[model samples]
Target: MAGLDDYQFFSTLREKDNPFWQRTSDDRDRLEDPMDHYRRPTEFPEDLRNPAHGTPGPPPTKAPAPTPKFNELEGQKVNDVQMEKYGELSINIVSLCAENLLSHPFIVVRRQCQVNISSHRYHVLPITIVPALLHIQSCQGFSAFWKGLGSVLTIKGITLGLEDCLSKFTPWPKDISPHSSIKTIGQHLLLKSSALALITPFYSASLVETVQSEIASEKPGVFDVFKEGLTRLLSFTQPQTGRMLPVWLLVVPTVTHGVLQYILGNSVSTLTSKLLRRLHRNDQHRQGAVSKDSGSFLDASIRLQSAFIGHMAADVILYPLETILNRLHMQGTRTIIDSLDVGYEVKPILTRYEGFFDCLNTTIQDEGFFGLFKGFGALCIQYALYGAVLKFAQVIIQEVTLALVPPKPKPKIQDPVTPLAPSAPYTPSSIHPGISSLHTSPLPPPRTPYGASPATRRPLGYGSPGRRQDVDMRAELEKHKSSLALDD
Candidate 1:
């Protein structure tokens, strides 16, 4: 009897080791009858029933199931980001072109107004915006309004591209804190001002082109105008000796005006940011909510408004310097420019400025302090229309983009399905009495590696480790996509 009991106990232990009888802890607890284990022994082959009687081989090694090379969601996200960048770029380019095209007439009138020699001898009086526009229209025809537009666009494109390239290549100091607004602004100013200084010749040439009236009967092409402007800019001859003036004379005023303008704009922007922050904080306090930082919708609107205001303020404040710079640009190029008066008459600059300070002093002495802001009204109106048009266009573009490519729907969250039990003749509940409770009771919430609550835990292949893997995978996918696009 004792020997039989020992055999049964060993057989039960052996049964537990068999793969066929393998079950979760819950399944083992579901056994109602102790004899059930003994009854199940006859179901397996003789070799599996008693491992000691036969040698058990190692399980076959199978290759891990291939993980997907790319995730659709991740790819979509990458595409969306790229699309946004491209869309913004297109919008900016379009906006710039549109603004320049629509507002260029005002610019032409303003330039003419600025360079007009207010003298009794020349009969060139200080011209207002409307009269100047009308005079230019009548004398030079309406087409004269866009005279130097090509040069302006060319200069703008070069400046923007050069600045972008310079900023990318510029070596930032390691010690400078990213949070230090002043240092960052200074660094940006240095780079941009340097860029401006480098392109002073082009800028001066363009300004000169804008103010000069065409003498030839045929309208010149953009390239021809640009070439002629460059020639004129370099051909500045000293009145006394007829020797060409040095390039540095043009560089000084242009660089100074650019640097001062940038500084004033940045100062205004910083002040506006601080004021917005204060107002936001006060509003948050009133609403009894935690104040959000500067990335919200309200903050974006504030930033846009501040930038617009800053640019306007800077332009208004620096109008005198701009006027002086224009005069300096035209100093040696003693060309007959449109007076923007009633008659079909043109006049040459009467006063020759030695330098920026000389130009400023002479203008004040001869034309009064207000002479510096000759075309101020036209400038204000141009910018106002530009801002309104740009804002409207952006909205239209955004709406069109949405209509063309609707945003993807958010993925739905489904409840986790309990892992299915292996197929067998007996149900899991019949395997053991204690396991019966497992089928009837709700599953315990799964614990995350990060100790997150089940409700907050993301599904497999998302968040933390999975998200990192997805990012790496997405990078590889992006490379492949770009290569494919290039090939196409």
Candidate 2:
């Protein structure tokens, strides 16, 4: 008859570091087995036997009156489950075939080629290959039958989400400088370097110094054009270092996938229309919803067609890079983190550009047509969800940062005095806000000479008469020259 309090109190006195005491305190049920008092249910309860319980019983054994069967039954009976299973099987077979045909050596070569082409186009190496490989290894225990499928979706989702979020707040050209003199060319270059810097450390800082040093080398204006063009291209694809796929390979596939889908989608829609027509034609005695003042089957069919098209289109655009990006991350490159110390030689050989195509075509030839779409089925799901979330998050982060930090204002200049014709009617546009006309009448300029003629003038020193007017005119000319210089 030991009390629970007695055990706990005694355990604390044993010492804080005592393993036995700690275990006893941490798991009271384990130390004192409660299953010793276990019980099992044997019979039904009184409430269950009572007819008052809300349990449903068998239906009355009676026949219903006959009614005309709608042809909708035929439409509904088209065996959608079977169709779905067939589609899944087709996807599996196609992906397997593609993988088998595309040999490991070819894949490696294609991956290396992707690195080269992407690096050439972007002027920076995407070192995500290492991370991508690592990811594959870690997840390698999973069946190769569905290889790259999950990874592709994950990569797409993250990259798209990040790009979307970053785009909204820090929309291109994403200028980072606070200095007014460095606003246009300087800031643009900074952004480009910054994006690259994220992947390859210190690239932006080095680029800045390079530009400044090169300022003395060329017509400074030519460099400005270079900065602008490079900035725009880089902005088009703001690559994130941690994405599942390397950013370089993301472009061609996404665009191609989107286009192909649009073309195929239209065909599928036509097929659906023919199927719906057949169903409507088969049923005469059965009154359709349209005939009874309800919604038409045609409308439902079209909606379904539209949904199907949209789903397939989205999948096409986002699926290819899904596993590739993940593969990139798992096989991440150290080059990104150590970009500053490393000097990259930017060059693209013909071999680099053709390698990916060779691998792709070879895989198809060996593995059958399905090899081209390896990992696509799983990727479809992955891209749909991942792309959506990643895009949204990145956009939000950029927007929030920009909104919190607004730009500063610049300095202004003072306008000088000017002469105006009294006979000419001066319009509002002709007059400067800060500067007023100096009168040219016969009057001694200001001071003790009150009520003098307006045309009178002043002297430089006490003896030099009308000399101040000459000085004033020269000053005005210099100011005019300065203003003109700024405009040019």
Candidate 3:
């Protein structure tokens, strides 16, 4: 069969009709329309016939009533739709705060880091804004800040809910539930990667270097498709180039964060747990939230713990990479504002390193490896604050949201088959509502008119205390007759 020509084999197989391999004639194949819209059968089978009269019988003695689909349970629906919407609004606010707080450290470090003119040997000094002045920011900066927060609330928020559905498929072990560190990092990767992709335009707009870098370039590469694509995306906007952030630059940190945590999480948590357990031998420590787990705060959630510890640790150890990435991205990226006019201005904030390794090598050669750790302090605060706000808000909001949402009432399901119909109609009682309700007649007690009670006593001829004998009817009649004649 494998070697035979297609025509020869197919023809032979088609012509052959051995009984074992043959197919019976089908009325369906003869249909004028092979793809007939309807398929209901025209013939009736024997089993389908009614047992009572050799034909399909009517429905059973009592057919079950169909249960109607309804939005409400019983007679009541969810009480407050407005309250739910309000809570949703507050949730968005919280998300914005969390996202901004998380990214502040990176922003501060990047803002301080300097750049040179394209291909220049010397580094330009940074225009340092006083700590308090960081509060005042560019219009483009506000755009990026709000965009990141909105992305977290809408895109990341929805993604988290969908991710929670993964739990519904299986009740995985404690190591794999929503609590697992590896699993949680994976969640972050999914969440952040998507969020980054969604708001890339805004991030690009926020960073002014993109346009500036593109302008200062002697030759543009085919790889600069990112800026070109972003320009198309923001075609409707006034300006597109310098006001934008690079997608890869923004995504790299989140991607790195997840991977680094995945690699370092188990070891760090294990060592931390062992150390926490050695705190005291008191019996009170035997059982409690803080007894065994290691986290950001005492007895805090593992997510908070992982984010705070993992992010800070990664920042410090890999702070050079962090700085390098920031510099790589921030070089020639700036958004300018003058008077009431808003537009993007090309300004190279860092020009020494064009790529990852270039930045890494340059930083080491010029400023030593310590240069990477420039924003370590601010970055640490950012990570720590993010973890605190995250965990604290989660715990508080969980309770608050729970309070806002009404709990589901247990169903009042009735047994369908068990008939418990009342024999009599209800009669209102002449009594208080809290007291006796239906005025049912009280039953009479058991007793008899005879001396002996009916339960234990026997008939007259039986062995009872009082029994009747035969009456002397003839003797009583003669005596009655004589007495009557004398009286007459």
- Model number with the top TM-score: 1
- TM-score for candidate 2: 0.23
**Candidate 2: where is the Cα deviation over 4 Å?**
1-250, 284-298, 309-356, 362-370, 376-488
Q: How well is each residue in 14-33 modelled by candidate 1, as lDDT tens digits?
A: 34443233564656687465
TM per prediction:
0.56, 0.23, 0.36
lDDT of 2 at 176: 31
Q: Against the unseen true structure, what C-alpha lDDT does each candidate score?
A: 0.63, 0.35, 0.43
| Per-residue accuracy of model 2 over 1-488 as CA lDDT, tens digit each | 12234334333433333322134445556445465345222234334564666774555456577787776544433443343344444433433343333232223222322223223121112242334334433543223223223333333343345444444666434433334354564444443333332332121212222212111222224234334324434654443433223334433443344344433554555566566555665563365433432123234333344445454554455433422322222222212211111112222212112223544554445544443344343333333434344334334533543454343333467696685534422112122223333212122322425565544433332223222222354554454455455556
lDDT-better candidate, 1 vs 2: 1
Error of 3 at 367 (Å): 3.6
Which stretch of 10 consecutive residues in model 1 shows the poorest summed lDDT? 435-444
Instruction: State which candidate, 1 or 3, has the greater TM-score.
Output: 1
lDDT of 2: 0.35
- lDDT score, candidate 1: 0.63
